[model samples]
Target: MKKVINKPEQVVEEMLQGVVAAHPQYVKRIEGFNVLVRANGPTAKVALVSGGGSGHEPSHGGFVGRGMLDGAVAGAVFTSPTPDQVYEAVKAVDGDKGVLLIIKNYTGDVMNFEMAAEMAEADGIKVDKVVINDDVAVENSTWTTGRRGIAGTVLLHKIAGAKAETGADLTEVKRIAEKVIANVRSMGMALSPCIVPAAGKPSFTLAEDEMEIGMGIHGEPGTHRENIRSADEIASHLLEKIFADMPLQQGDEVAVLVNGLGATPLMELYVVNRKVAAVLNAKGIKTAKTFVGNYMTSLEMAGFSITLLKLDAELKALLLAPADTPAFVQF
Candidate 1:
């Protein structure tokens, strides 16, 4: 309930305004719509558009710039953006090379984004879509019919966006995105809960000494909650589950992403990363690149998710390619 804002109902609108206020050079709003597009783009290359709810910041929106998303549609907190909004985004960012939609594997997100894609195609804009289901947590969740997409979606953005930036067509870009979706695996744990502004109450409750393994970003029930463990133990547990799902061999390569769920501190994330790196080294898995920070987040949620992207040469190079965005940048 303690949020800095004018009104709960206006949070998404105001947040978008603030984002543009801070990064006008990178993004601009689609007037009257809760959609953001790259400020100076939609160039003659395959464009990327992805979105879900609004709470997962620096995600679908903060990534609107070169080498990432070309457009992002924002819904209300934890709610899916409507088809009209998504259609607007597709229209705004399509540069004649076609557009690619990177959707998380949530029921609403799948339905809405696909509806938008259909509408865009009706308008003669070529569009392709890929769904990300990288969370090794569960087969189904409150909002999704399959494994929920978590932080690994960001890696999808990076790799596919890089391919698109290379002037790849929609089909090729979508193929790369699907490859990332196939190779990436993620798991998360939460030490505390977060409050949604409109709800004015905690999304879920966790006892002080308990932690949730495989926690979903929207506070959906995870695999189970148990007594809190050390950072190393938690990291190892997450990695174990990931490896179990996608067995990595010694000498394999990967890119690591230690993502914060809004309220988790950088210090804690790094602590988790330390163990992640140690485990991968012990397994002889060469890490190509590592990113540790708040890439995708549930609003004010106190947790972290570890994502490991099994990498081949193509994926490794695309991941390391230059990207300039509000939330992510690499030279």
Candidate 2:
């Protein structure tokens, strides 16, 4: 219950205000709605909008900028935003080129974003969507049918956004997003549970020496739990699962993202990345680029996930394209 906030009900509103205040040049709030659109919105380029809950900061919102998302709708912590909010975002960001929605593979996210797209189409705004289900964890968990979207979604944003920035239409943008989804795979482990502000308690409990494997970002119980092991051992276990599922082979090039959930420090993330790179190198997979940091998060969860995207020439170029956003930037 040790949260630094004014009130539980006002948390999302206050946070959105803070984000707008902090990044006025890159984003602006749509008045009377919990939506953040790029400062220079309604551009002719295919607009990209993605969102879900609020706790995964610098995600759907932090990415609203050039070469990334054009708009983001915010829901309460770990809750899906309403279709009305999403519809407004589509309307606000759509220009002559239409809009694309990058929705994660959660049921609520899928349903809500679909409703919004339908509404937008009713209003004559062309819209398309791509669902990210890149987590190679488990299928048919209590929460979802297929895999859950995790750190791989960030790669989706970058690659799809780059395509859109280059004047790709909605169809092309969505196709590229799906291409990223098909090539990316992710797996995560949690050492400690996250405390949701409103709940005032950890979402789940894990013993001091235990870790949960194949966990989702919302603190849902993972596929299995085991005694905590060394960083290298943990990295091997995660990579083994991912590579088995994806079957990465020799002479393949990939992009690596070792993402800290929230509370884990960069030091530990790099430690995990070291082991991950060693594993990939031993497997004869060449990593063209590596990103080790908290790109995607689950509030204050103490854990991390690793995402690997098998890259082609176009994907590699898009992955290296410049992007400027509040949470991530590359030149």
Candidate 3:
């Protein structure tokens, strides 16, 4: 309810304007559309476009630069972008190498992005897509038929984008994207809910000493709620669920992402990562890389999500490859 904006309906539009203004050297708009593409787009390599509702900043948009996304479409807060919007993004970033759509598993996102793919194909632009179902928390959430993609989608962006930057063909880029989707898993817990600007109300509520575990990014109901627990306990439970879904063994290479949900502090996130790191080390799992901070987020929701990406040599090298984006940059 307490948002600093002129009007609720105009939030997405104004936000996109601000983003382009702040990073003109990195991205540009599609003119009267909620689309952001690399300032130097329409390149010779395969283009990567992904999007969903707004609110999760520095996601599809923040990753729009070299070694990451080529374009990103934004909808209303927690709302899906239309197929036309997505189609325009594909057109704007389209190169001879083709375009790849990195969609999360939400129903609207899947439908809209897939529709755009078909539309592009009709025009002879080769398009392929990979739906990320990395959330290990639930099978079917309110907005998705299967697992909802959460922070793990960012890892997919990094690795797959690096592949595309190498002048890889569309088919090969998609193959590497699928490989990341197959190996990544994530789970989240929230201490508080967020308020949508239009609604002027919190999406959900929790007691002062309660937290929702396995919650989706859009405030969907999670597996269960419990009294506030220690950070170690929470991290352990989340990892327990992750391993239950995909068991890992000694000497396994992996990457860790401790993502903040809007309002969670970096200090708290590092504390949680400490526990995550201790657990992986104790188990003899080799961590190739670890990222901590607000990579993906809800709108001022007090929570965090943990993501694990099982890595091979190819994945490790690409993940650590040089990327220059607004939100994420690595050498």
Candidate 4:
């Protein structure tokens, strides 16, 4: 229950204030709401908005800038934002080209974002949406009906934002987003669980020498728990599941993301990436790009997740496009 905060209930509000203060040039708050919108305001192009619970920093909010999300709604730790909060984000960012909601596949996220979209539509705003189900770990989890969206959603954000930056229409932006969702697959493992601030206790427990594979980001049940294994073994186990689900073959070009859950060190993430690259190379799959570090995370959870996005020319081009955000920047 060791945490650095004044009060659990006030964590999200204080965090938003800090984020805006730190990055005023890039983002601003929606007055009294837990919403972050681009400081430059809405554009003539399609607007991108995505968010979930608050613990996964640098996600929907840190990604607000020139070439990423237009707005991001934040909820309590591991809880979905209210529809009104999401609606405020939509109203703040929507331009004539319309707004696209990049919702993860969590039950609450899906419901709340969709309700916001409908609310916007009634207000004469054109809104389109995409639900990301990139987690190959499980079919139905505690918070979602389908696969839970994990780090792969960040890739979707990059690709979709790049397309929107090109003045693409809403339909075109959503089409490209779906392409990324279709090609991407992710799976995660957890060494230790995180403690929600309000709860002041770990969400789950694990032994000193045990790890659970195919775990969701919110510390939900995974595929299995077993004695801790080497980095290579863990990487192989995850990659094998991905390959079985999608069957990546020879000559296939792919992008790899070795993401830290929260507490895992960069050294360990790079170790996992080394093994991931080896496995891909051994299968004759070409690695087009490799991203290592924390993209999406639980609240101080000890583990990592691997994400693979099979790439085509269009996807590769957009993924490599320039982006300037607080957490992710590409040139």
Best by lDDT: 3
TM-score of 1: 0.98
- Candidate 3 segments whose C-alpha is farther than 4 A from its true place: 140-144
| lDDT (Cα, 0-100) at 54 in candidate 3 | 91
lDDT sort, best first = 3, 4, 1, 2
Clash pairs detected, candidate 4: none
Candidate models: Cα lDDT each: 0.92, 0.91, 0.93, 0.93
Q: For model 2, how does the per-residue alpha-carbon lDDT over 1-331 read when each residue is reduced to its tens digit?
A: 7777899889899999999999999999999999999998878999999999888887879998988899999998988899999999999999879999998888899999999999999999999999999888875355437778888999999999999999988888888898999899999999999888889898789998899999999888888999999999999998988888889889999999999999999999999999998998899999989999887899889999999999999999999999988877889
Please provide the root mean square deviation of candidate 4 (C-alpha atoms, Å): 1.5
Can you write out model 1's per-residue Cα lDDT over 1-331, one digit (the tens) per residue? 7788899999999999999999999999999899999999778899999999989998889998999899999999988899999999999998999999989988999999999999999999998899999999885445447898889999999999999999888888988998999899999989888887889998789998999999998878899999999999999999999998999999999999999999989999999999999999999999999999999999889999999999999999999999999999999
TM-score of each: 0.98, 0.97, 0.98, 0.98
Give candidates' CA RMSD values in order. Answer: 1.5, 1.4, 1.5, 1.5
- The alpha-carbon deviation from the true structure for residue 246 of candidate 4, after best TM-score superposition, in angstroms, is 0.9
lDDT of 3 at 304: 96
Task: Give the alpha carbon lDDT tens digit for every residue of 1-331 in model 3.
Answer: 6778999999899999999999999999999889999999989999999999998997779999999999999988998899999999999999889999999998899999988888999999999999999999985445447899999999999999999999999999999999999999999999999988988999789999999999889888899999989999999999999998889999999999999999999999999999999999999999999999988888889999999999999999999999999999999
* Candidate 4 local lDDT, residue 146: 84
